[model samples]
Target: MPKITELRGLFKPFTKPLHRQWKYVWQEKGKFNEPKLTLPKALNGRQLNIIDPLHDPDPNALPDESTPWTSPTRHPMFEYLVPPLPREQHPLFHHDQPVFLFDSKTKLHAGVDQACLLTKAIPFYELPQSIKQNLDKISIPNQDDLIQSYIRQSIAYDATKEHLPRKSTPLKQHRSFRIEYGIPRSRQMSILFENILHLCESLGGRYPDLFKRHLYRNTPFYTTYERYGEPIHLRNKNSYVLTSHTPLSPIVKRLNKLEISSGEKNDEKLSTHDPDGHYLMKGNDYQFLNMYPVYPTIDLQPEELYQDGDELGWRQRKTNEYVHTTFYVSNDELIHESTTDERLARMVMFAFGSALVQARQQYPNGNLIKPVTVQSVFLLDELFHFVVFQLNTLNYNETNDNRYNYVWIDKDNYMYDNRPSMVMHNPVYGTERNLQRYVLEKLKYNPDVFQKFLALYLQGIQGKKE
Candidate 1:
């Protein structure tokens, strides 16, 4: 006969917990804090079996004796709060165009404009002579000439590496382009709502009726789901189905309606994840409007060359590179700030560049059904500079371009001290019309570049209507 210890070893596998049961216990108590309860022992030197009463076969019992354990169905307590009808179909609900809002709180630290005129400037030529020379050397296809011309005009590289002395070696070139720019990850939506409120108020003062009809304070949520072909038993083993939410825009609804009306096959089913969109703008404080869009760019580190064996000269080696895509506007007023005409020019260029890229993405394959408009607001401490650009054409074939028009409103001097001016006003319940008239008069009397821009903007608006 086998010893008692050997018999216990023979039945050890049956007495031990199954992998699934062990996992459940571990999940409940955590790996480090497992329970100290004694495990089941073998029965009579054989595998022990404890039949559950619910699953046991009883001849006299009903057919429901083998019912598995299941969690009780739960109903949300707030189910009564959900409205019977959809909010969008409600008579009181308002739906309007979505507005993109950007805010920056960077303070003008050092007056670089007063110190050195050339230090902070980014020089560019409309038709740079270097572009012609570059074109002469490189046989660029006719299709690519326009883009090459734009690049030549926009970028200038230092040739110090090419003319280095014999003893001094140059670093390897590692240029990178940023996919997206502005607003750091940590502070992306930090002041978004605050800035939206200010923008609404400012525009509302000048165009009350337009604001009421066109501006939307909220957007609906959109959700998408994906499913995998798996058996029902293995559905929970891995995530067989996944669900996610996407940002909703008013344009999406308009597109969907157009698709349905045109009898086009729509692949996407549009529905809101939330009953109502998030409230973006609230409160009366308008100080957050004085924010700027930080340009996205990559920083290149100095390249290091290694001399592998004396036979070969110094060769460039690959190195790890760090890239930053998100940069948020800061509200710290004590930071030193510098500004120059060149810096401002570069900022404008980047603003237009990014806007153009976004426009191209939206209206891909040369689709010009609707014009693209980008509004950029630059906040320099207390100063505010608003720029509006309307892209009428997006053909890259034309080397010399005249398809876009822009208006820049620089309210630096008048609104510098934060006084009650034409642009800056106290919030009044019923005095919007009076404020509009006051702003229009101020625009007429102002002997600045903004006055001419405003006139042009009004002309464009009127022309569009006609």
Candidate 2:
């Protein structure tokens, strides 16, 4: 029990005195849990003293100003100088490494609404009709056999999955624990990618040189973008898998080759004259989405502005400079949920951002350089979202630069549906028959999707450039 003085010191600054707390009743147990009937309900039609009557000549009739909550401010008998409540520090105030390590740092992840805004790209939802028509032309050697083998591997991976450390902590924060169910998301992703890569490798004899490219894990691809006079930086420290080398050919021809009128901009063409959806409030950009900064945005001084494109430890001499494909796996993490539309947004932004970085590395001075292209594959839930971005132009100029990047998004792709396993593995649900309960049947396998994946992979392998 706290001392009366201590209790008062703690809560009195923020709370009101008993008399000042009008209309609030502390009914005694003597009342046997029944609420005290003060007066007839004012809004009730049958109440005799109800205020619905037309006459208002009762001059001496005083109002119930003394009732609870009658005054906005406290109705204390004597006013005294009340000190404001003491402010407390964050839970992890003493944490050696804070969430944002540097001063006034903003971590902008690739997201849906800001994808077009960040990349300054023209979005062609789904693969273009031309790409679709060309899909049947690019045939993978022994694709059916490969897919079956791939499916087998995928199932095996799924059936064999076992939880390692089933629970973990937040990023650098202590004491707070997070419980993860089933196989870890990272392991599930790894298994999925491993299966895909293994399947891809099975064709090494036929396309030997195409398999020469390397795959990197948990790589960081940090880049900066300026939006609405604010420099937003994205330090993608957890890019699941980034396949480098193997140049990609754009589905459409380069912007410089095509003769587009100087009077027209791609964004404007997409937006028309209407200010809707994305353009609903231009001055209010991402802020208008109702998703603000996780913590209060740190106000920085003028001196804190950075030199922007500082590629971390990625040297120019590295042979595998061109980013071929990036694999991202998203789930219901504490930070962001992998919703359908949001996943597409992430894929587009990730593709464009990676391409921009690659472009900057190759053409430092903004001289004559071929466009950089990046393909992003995002896996959320069981669905796969594919995005291909061709970064045609970047900041040698202003916001509405005529030369815009081209992006194609196809998010309605799932490799294979989950299935009930006789191979009895991890418990996916309750204590019994978890596998049968959770996994979806594998009957809904889509061969065309993986074919498209292979097509995207092999597009420019035939016509490789330096």
Candidate 3:
């Protein structure tokens, strides 16, 4: 590994220009208008198994004669919760509750203006197998230009790798997949309800409606499930079909009537997925406004809206203030010790003010909107969350006085700290980071991946940094 000083020196010069270039290129090409080049689906073409439960023995269930063993347990009520109840709960409800607390949905109401957290896995699975197989061979507009441009970048990075000690490699930064769904127009609003009806028809009962009603009733609320797959299973599983006599909401019932043709029990054309097995068919439906895929591109710094005096330090202050407000500071003692509603009021003001300053510094002639400028403020929360994770991973929880264990003082009187442990410890986090790193290493050595790291870090900061 390179020395910290040497790495810093090597990285410092490239930060500003690279930041400008990344912002420009990413913002320009990240929009829906940017034609997504198609690639062949990988898993879509497989001979997916959709076994009938009646035809085969229960795969998910444990054999009745199986012995049960106990393991060490943890949790507040573990001592009282009794041991080794049964072997039936094989698929244990071991959910990451902490992960759900900082879910993407929470950020929607926060100041994260127009963000997209498109899971590559979901899109990759949704495409047809035939289409995915031919992805590499597909000829799409602007695709070649982008690839060529990246290739040239890679060649340059390869030539200079030794001096720079490149931390990231070049890889295809942009990917797109195609989706095709032919849902009838009338049934568009009630897709969930209609899907339940199909389940009932297939299984010869009115059962699918229970899950639909449950989900519908809990819409726009914080809900939890043992598994994300449970919803899919409830909709697709053939055996042990769930039934409910629950009546649908007026809107759903009307929409269902409109969608079904006279005496037509099924709308086969619009549906996609294995009839014999359960696997989610993922894609954006262009035909439906609510369900359409939002291929979004966000402008981090709108050049048209810029103001002066915005520097790195100012940006930090602005970001801090935004985080303080967005997170409910319910602790009365913390607020009472301070003389001013100053802390709360200062939060939004400083964030917006600094954002304006930062934007103006980048675009001297641009017009800055105070509200939109606060978008950068959203990034600060994610940053703080990372800091907490770093501290926690280092066994330095802030709730205790040992927080100092995670901090180090630099010669410049600056505090140098470890990148948060949050990204390192979580399996999902590790997976994403590893995939990104893999892609980076594959690409020609460049700062683009680091920039992506920073962006995602900012995103995490906004949602979870608090």
Candidate 4:
């Protein structure tokens, strides 16, 4: 045989063509090759009765009494294993204790501040002026033009992905026949936020890393606390909850944070009282003027079996315990048309703040280690309800001058006035029905509203370097 030489590829040209060169080069087995394969053994210590090939089986049934057995075993390990009994018991219903219900299915209470009273939050009408000034100061590249582009692009994605507003089913009700149908609010909201984040990355280029470390979605969390010696709980899930490695710097002034005068904590009707008046605010008292004759806890249904976890969207880790913001897009479960924007904003701040306080692993009736600031936005269709909550203490029973928590809300922000509509003669209704109908034409965005949203998103992260 010719001397073997080092080669690089499979199809190298040979000087003299022959069968021997082909055999050594292609078919020769070396150290890397394994021995011939062995068939797997049969189960239950009995070999499978295969006459020849896998497809060849005994066509005629052999009687079990006449069949010959090679071997049998009485070993205990060969028998099927039985499952062990459960150590803990699980119940179907909450029989022992009733937990106050604050889930999505809960209806709107008569008073706007019901959730506030339960969570021990003080409500402010507008956002802090310092935040507004900071918003105005934030700069963007060609923001006016980019805002409109983003608005159009987001709507395009929503329309292309989802079915258009066309007549599908025959409805008997007149109110149900809508010629101008708005796209699904939740879907559109996600598209818009994604586009905005992309824009922020293009301009500022730090949001991607921030979101990687902070943002999480669909993580279930709940805060358990007591109200008037009764157990209460609130769960927050299926929303975008952004957290940070460290707590947000306190927003309220040092003096105001130290103590909120009972006068400040009291309602407007009580506002007329002397500025220096000494008012004693009770833990269970309804601070606002009541529309409902009963207590704020009127409709809270309870559960004996409540989730004991106080996670802020992740497992107990060394990072991202502090919640920075929660973007609540309208889910039909949590938001309804009957509830006003103002009330919804208040409810979100209370529920989210309670979650943060619990995440800190602090006692519900005691002071928090530090202030937990949470900024939130509630987007329903086009309206944007912005809220900022600073939870200082969960000690509602404190008789001292300590301030509990603060919530700042700006409820009057809209992305656009109306979507441009065009008349279309749709044939789905047939010739009998009037041809008068309107279809979505295009989207015209607002610059100021988008700026406000961007400002809120970039609030605490502006000072960070690349």
lDDT of 4 by residue, 1-466 (tens): 5335535432347653666656656664333454553456644466555343434457653347666543255356744443322323444345566677676556545434766666667666677655777677766878777666666555542444443344333243333335544444466667777676566555445444355445778777676667667777776664777666555666653423233334445554433452211122322232654535666667677566666645566776755366667776666423333467435634554445444655356445454556667788776656677887777665666567456566677876777665422222234533211211111243445677777777776666634446
The candidate with the higher TM-score, 1 or 3, is 1
- Model 1 Cα lDDT, one tens digit per residue, 243-283: 11111111111221212211233222322331111100010
- Candidate 2 colliding pairs, count: 3
Name the TM-score of candidate 2.
0.55
Winning model by TM-score:
4
lDDT of each: 0.27, 0.53, 0.25, 0.57
Error of 4 at 19 (Å): 62
TM-score computed on alpha carbons, candidate 1:
0.26
Please give the distance, in angstroms, between residue 465's alpha carbon in candidate 3 and its true position after superposition. Answer: 22
The residue ranges of model 3 lying beyond 4 angstroms of the native Cα positions read 1-310, 314-335, 339-341, 368-372, 375-466
Clashes (N, CA, C under 3 Å) per candidate: 7, 3, 27, 2
Please give the lDDT score at residue 87 for candidate 3.
36
For model 3, what is the C-alpha lDDT against the true structure? 0.25
lDDT of 4: 0.57
Better of 2 and 3 by TM-score: 2
